[model samples]
Target: MDILLFLIIIFIASILQTSTGFGFSILATPFLLLLFEPMEAIQINLLLSLVISAVLIKKLLKDVDTGILKRFVMGSVIGLPIGMMTFLFIDLNLLKLGISVIILVLTLLLVMRFRMKQYKKRDFVVGGLSGSLTTSIGMPGPPILLYFSGTDTKKEILRSTTLAYYLFIYSISLVVQLIFAGTSKTVWVSSGIALPLVLIGLYVGQKLFVRINQTTFRIFTYIILLFTGLYLLLESL
Candidate 1:
């Protein structure tokens, strides 16, 4: 039953990620935590996310915005350590609640037609925010999603660039978690079993991406953001 449940979650999350480039970790981690220990769940999430990005990188390479990705990486380098510090000292429950609220409110505003003008520097800022969130809360998609959605970035570019960024971030995160937090054998074994499911999900997600238009994509993004926010809020409370 546990394996079946894991397969189902990963399949849905994989489709979301392969299509939109940002939902795998955000949507999978919470449910994974319910079934596995925190360390193991997080390790599994990071590993699978890395695989998703790796699998799609070659295909999406053409759509990637290199300038934005570079800026985001530079800023993430600065934010990663700070996020680790925050993880060590901050009240985690409160942090979760705060992040959840911010995500929910920002997503709502964007849904209501709020716009943020795209500036060169905003990429760095968003990247930094994403990096911090990645380490602190194990979810990095909301910042990038919110930024792109607000700026009305095209679906193709948004999907590709975010996946490119995830390729880098998830790899680094996997290394850091392995070195500092450690993982169980179960995490590896489970991830291995789930690899086929991930691939299936990716294939389906790619198909959906081809068929989805901008408006539909935005609506999907909004729904994911809302779901992530509510999930975190409930967990924290």
Candidate 2:
């Protein structure tokens, strides 16, 4: 039953991620913690997220925002090491509690029609936040999602740029995890089992993306953010 349930979780999460370019880990990680140990769950989420990015990179490359991507990558390089240190020393539940609150508040603000100006270095800031969050919580989508949503970026650019950035961040994260925090064999086995489901979800999700407009995409993103924030809050409690 756990195996069956795990597949379902990954499939649905993959669909959201593939469609929006930023949700697989946010939607999947908390549930994965229920099915596996913390490190194992995190490793699985990272590995699967890498797969999602790899699969979508070719398709989404045309829409990638190179200028934004450059800043995000540079900022992420600084943030990754800090996140690794935090993962080792910080109280994860406490950190998660903080993140959850931020997610909730930001999501609410976005829903209230709050918007942000596009500053020159905003992508860098968002990317740094995303990188730290990725390693600390195994979920990076919230910061980028919030930033893009706040700036009211176009759906195509948002999806492509985020997906492109994930490829870089997820790869670095996996290497860091492997070096500093080794994974058990079970992590590999489980990720292998879920790969097919992830692929299927990606296929279906890409189809759905074609039909979704900006308004629909934003609404969908907000729903995911709300659920993610609520889930993290409940988990922390």
Highest lDDT scorer: 2
Model 1, 95-144: lDDT tens digits are 88998999999999998999999887999999999888777667878899
Lowest-scoring 10 consecutive residues by lDDT in candidate 1? 79-88
Question: What TM-score does candidate 1 reach?
Answer: 0.96
Name the runs in model 2 displaced over 4 angstroms.
none
What is the lDDT, from 0 to 100, of the residue 153 in candidate 1?
Answer: 97
Candidate 2's TM-score: 0.98
Question: All models: lDDT?
Answer: 0.89, 0.91
* Total residue pair clashes for candidate 1: 0
Those runs of model 1 whose alpha carbons end farther than 4 Å from true positions after fitting are none
Poorest 10 consecutive residues by lDDT, candidate 2 = 118-127
Clashing pairs in 1: none
